[model samples]
Target: MPDYKAPLRDMRFLIDHVFDFHGHYAGLGATDASPDMVGAILEEGAKFCENVLSPLNRSGDEEGCHFDNGVVTTPKGFKEAFAQYVEGGWHGVAADPAYGGQGLPSSLGLVLSEMIGSSNTSWGMYPGLTHGAMSAIHAHGSQAQKDTYLTKLTAGQWTGTMCLTEAHCGTDLGIIKTRAVPQANGSYALTGSKIFISAGEHDMSENIIHLVLAKLPDAPAGTKGISLFIVPKFLPESGERNGVSCGSIEHKMGIKASATCVLNFDGAEGYLIGEANKGLNCMFTMMNHARLGTGMQGLCNGEASFQGAVKYANDRLQMRSLTGPKAPDKAADPIIVHPDVRRMLLTMKAFNEGNRALAYFTAQLLDTAHLSADPDQRQEAEDLLAFLTPICKAFMTETGLEVTNHGMQVFGGHGFIREWGMEQLVRDCRIAPIYEGTNGIQALDLLGRKVLGSQGKLLRGFTKIVHKFCAANAEHPQLKVQVAKLNQLNQQWGELTAKVGMAAMKNPDEVGAAALDYLMYSGYIILGYLWLRMALVAQAQIDNGSGDPDYARGKLATCEFYFKRLLPRTATHRAAVEAGSECLMSLPAELFAL
Candidate 1:
């Protein structure tokens, strides 16, 4: 396994030059987030990820987590690594200062998350889950509730988990069998078995805070009746075991080091977080966080795999270039000399860089949504976020899977072996698209609800962004080609939506049939806009004779590659979406079983 090094250069480029995060922070009233301070934080964070976490990727997978007698212990070095993480205050970078957090921008925290995720995603899950739980508490928990849970969670003395999935229900929260009966003391007694709970029951934290969903005794049926609860593994005041226990840990493929526990809550004393039956609303707060984080996991896996592939391709001598010998000094030539290898490498490069831009851009939107004092600004940012979240989650992960497969293919047979670490990336990333509301579901959310539900209003918010960008760069000599493509795609997006909307009116199945393809189409254009933005920035740097020449040139090259090679795939998705529901729905339930 190649040692993971944080792509600080690219991260810095996006923060400092591409996005002007410094200006963004000042606008948001985060005066303390100076360039020097954030730089130091990234520097220190990179060290923590590179030295502390990267080494654990393979070891953690091999050791996995242990389960015995209702206790779950993480892999070796995980406990100590977590303690060091807490001591360093990395857990509270983006948390509120009112709750003992550092009061920095959430965007900065996302930067750290990318490093942690790329280094060791399994190790990242513990703190990742805690942050999600903390976000829920900070948003909706009562004053006393915040005082009790937020501070501890912000400080990383306690960990948290979102308990939603069950044996019978993964996406359908309406079918949840968990029950919460009201006790006279304003609390509830919860009894349910939740499966696929990551970091659910672990020994690293003093106490585990579970933000659980269940049906109240007198509530209505289905999702409308669901409610959120704060269930702890141990009573906070008494330090005694609560009714919650780990029935067993799932023996799974990949992410083996992260505990995926089947938690059994037998009449566990749980406190209601928000109004009864509004749990789904509050749960979205946590789910949104995990969804975006899952998207980053996709970026991480693709990045790590790309790094390995590039290194191997440059060193593994195979055949000579078709034209001539590129590396005449070597035995034959490094496999990188091959055209197909370059295609794969460039594809990974294009997505890895394009996705990074999207992630950080979305991060900036997150800051605007949370920190802006202006109401309209906040709402606009939030709306854009609501529109982009599903796209980012599904599109990035799907591309990540593709990138990793390409990465593995570069290695020939060695990719299948554990020692190479390429296969681990594929196995680990396989879960991202499955969990986090599966990519298929994400597609529906984008097409059915966000786009069509609003009559293209939500989508226009994003396309208008591309609209302005294309308008601004319309005259650039080198970029006009891409700018024109973006302009056409931007217009095509709305027209396509209108067409799908018309079809869906008559046959609702058209929405489902067109969704996944629609989402992918949207993703390519979204990424196209981002790549163009990078190209413009990089071209300006090259023209001015400023910045690192190699970096700038590489950015320009990849941007061109994406436009030429990758962006055309959007057309296929467009055709698929416009094909309508007939071909798909015409197939009866009782198909030809010949």
Candidate 2:
């Protein structure tokens, strides 16, 4: 296995050049966070992830988690490793300062997340869930709620879980049957069974907070009546727990050390998160954050798999090259000498780098949207961020699975075996596209809510930014052609958006059927644009001699690969989107036999 190393140089290039993160941080009122400070923080975070958490990854997968009745235990060494993780103060890197948090810019925290996730995704889930829960509480919780749970969650003394899915209802919140009854003491009695709850029941923390979605007795029907509640395992006076318990833990395909539990809230004590019957709104706060993190998981796993494949390709001696002996003294040439091997490696590199840029760019936009002094600038940032979120989650995860599979293919038979850790990467990444609202759901949100509902305003705003980048860099010989390609794609996207919007008005199923492919097509164009921007940034840095020449050269090479090889997929996605709903919904119910 390759030694995990954080791509700090690449991260810095994105932050400093592509996003101008320092300026954004200052805009966010993070006056203390200079470039040097950010670099130092990233370095420490990288060291912690590489040295403390990464080594546990293989062992965690191999050992998995153990469940005994109602108690769930993580793999060996995870407890100590998690303690180290919390001790490093990483749990609150981007959390609010008012609640034992460092209040760092989310852009910096995003880079740290990639590193930690690349190092050990399974272990990463423990803190990952905590952050999501913390965000929900901070955004919607009352002052007392914040004072009680926020600080403890930030400190990593207690873990958190989001309980939205039941066995019957995953994406359709309207079908959820969990009931929350008002109690005499201002708390509610929650009784329901929730499944697929990550970090729901774990021994790592003294208490586990569950942000559950249920319904009130008098609530109207469907999603309009849903509500959010905070139920804790033990009743906490100060920072203690409430009466929440884990019914059992789930046995999953990968991420073995992360406890996925079946939680049973049997008359459990609970408090409302925000206004009654507005749980879906409050839950979206957490879901959106989790969606981004899940995307990072995909990016991180893809990078990890790529790193392993690269090492294996460079070190493993195989048949000699067709041209000549690249290593005449050795038994055979390295596998990297083969074009097919290079193809797989380059493909993985292209998607990993592209997704990295997209994730960081989105995070930067999030920070700007939150902290910009001008309301107009903030609204613009928010709009673009909303438009990109679904792409970040759906497109990135979809490609992440593809890249991981490519990495596994590079390993041949060894990839399938559990010993080399390639198979686990595939399994772990598979869930990202499925969970977090599923890629299908994300697609619907992108088209139905973001594009069609917003009347293409947000999409147009984003394309304008791309156009401006292209116009400013028109002199760059290498990137000029790629920028032109993006311009063409942007035009097509606009036309397609109009067509889909018009068609959907007549036939709603058309939107449902084409939504997924449209989201993917848009994502490809957006990521392709991002890759070009990153390459341009790297080229500028190289000319200025500010960073390593090899790093810049690598960036340029990956950008080339993305344009030449990966960008072509937009054509197929466009075709699929244009196919409309006929093929999908053409079949009648009686066509199938019982």
Candidate 3:
């Protein structure tokens, strides 16, 4: 059977050492998130994932979800599995206490998300969408809306989804045909068909709260006219079916167990969540939450693939090592003995660790953005999150797909087969880059909006942090090389952004041309800084003395591998970014087709 074990040790390393959640929570005055409490939470969360969720992953995929007569039934074990999850009090780990939650730090919620995602991504989605909905309602919903919707969502008695896409529009929400008419009783009659709604219609919850985006009559044109609505599957007051119904679910390439529904709202009763004509703005609250979660999915998949690859490499014997057979008793050495195999393993490892640092750091910033008392700190954190979210969404998932591919490659032919389970990881990871706004869109957001829109202030927010870290650790005896390399990249990031900005002014297409490469280049540098931070923590642990030698040594070695092997990829991206748009746009649109 396919298997997964939570990387509790590494998570603890980040929580206890690198980001120092103990200190972070203490600073936030989050007394409930004490180290022991957090540790217990991680331990319990790990058990739920490893024991409860992991066992269902392969079974869920093989069986998938069944759609019949406008009804969706999850794989046999899913309902039960989700029940255990809800019973564990995990549904509201980070939600507000007033609404049946544990009232822990939001970062802890992300920690559980990573675990659940790695264990069973499809299963994870059932409750995952609820988080984004809860955030949207909390941030924008009125007290009545909060009491009616948030209470049930936080308690896991109800689930939620975001209904945005339609037949004609996916990313272009302005062209969506969904319409809402204001009624005498204050509710709106919502009529539209929304496609690709994950967890939109499911049997796991008593009710499903859909946050729908539609246009009001006489509303302005395009995305600006869009208005947000809360359309529940069961009316909160009447307890009767609302207009929302499951038209059908898509036959997908992967994540099949998660219902991707075609929801038809035929005069469905919905209450406006935010001001009319400002739905897009309100929807961003949910989109951003989901975007970050999607990015974590990338990391989770890479981590899952890496775990499989490591186990397979250590057990699967192939050819002799260049130096000689390390396993002399066997016919040939384990694949781990080969340098090429080691390269792949290290690549996955470096990215897994580096991305975890980035995610955790971003999570810390999220806590500050949401909870910090200091306005400046909150704004700085929010500004940095705006810059990091797209990078997290795009770069992590792209690399995640690469890692899954490599994991399967490690198994050679066996990886392609269903029995070993490596291929499923690849298939499941493919959607992350496509959904949550395509990576291309993410790049555009980074270069066109976040980076350029702010006149480079947003980019400066993160780069300045890297600059400060480099300055503080410049003279370190053990990390001088990494610190130097980081400083060089740190300096170059600003210069490259400036160059792209100048080129974009001369030709706006230059931004589009350079966006993908720029995002990747930024990702590498960001990971480089994260790796440096991790190396410092690992080095401190080693110097502090007395612990598992392999864990500490492994951390240092992987940091070195990232600097030597992976960090240099930024050069290629930098060259691509500097190449401008002339070569890219010179060809006519019709000429290439023939």
Q: What TM-score, to 2 decimals, does candidate 2 have?
A: 0.97
Q: How high is the CA lDDT of each candidate model? A: 0.93, 0.88, 0.92
Q: Which lDDT tens digits does candidate 2 get at residues 139-225?
A: 899999999999999999888889999999899899899999999989999988999999888779888888999999998899999
Give TM-scores for every candidate, taking all chains together and pairing residue i with residue i.
0.99, 0.97, 0.99
TM-score of 3: 0.99
- lDDT score for candidate 2 against the true structure: 0.88
Model 2 alpha-carbon drift over 4 Å, by segment: 238-242, 542-546, 589-594
lDDT of 1 by residue, 1-594 (tens): 768989999999999888999999998999999999999999999999999999999999999999999999999999999999999999999999999999999899999999999999999999999999999988889999999999999989999999999999999999899999999988899999999999998879899999999998888989999999999988898889889999999888889999999999999999999889999999999999999999998999999999999999999999788999988887889999898999999999999999999999999999999989999999999999999999999999999999999999999999988999999999889899999799999999988889899888899999999999999999998889889999999999999999999999999999999999999999999999999888888999999999998999999999989989999999999999888889987888788564
lDDT of 3 by residue, 443-462 (tens): 99999999999999999988
- lDDT for model 1: 0.93
Positional deviation of 448 in candidate 1, in angstroms?
Answer: 1.2
Better of 1 and 2 by TM-score: 1
lDDT for model 3 comes to: 0.92
Candidate 3, residue 500: Cα displacement in angstroms equals: 0.9
Residue 326 lDDT (model 2): 100
lDDT value, residue 415 of candidate 1: 92
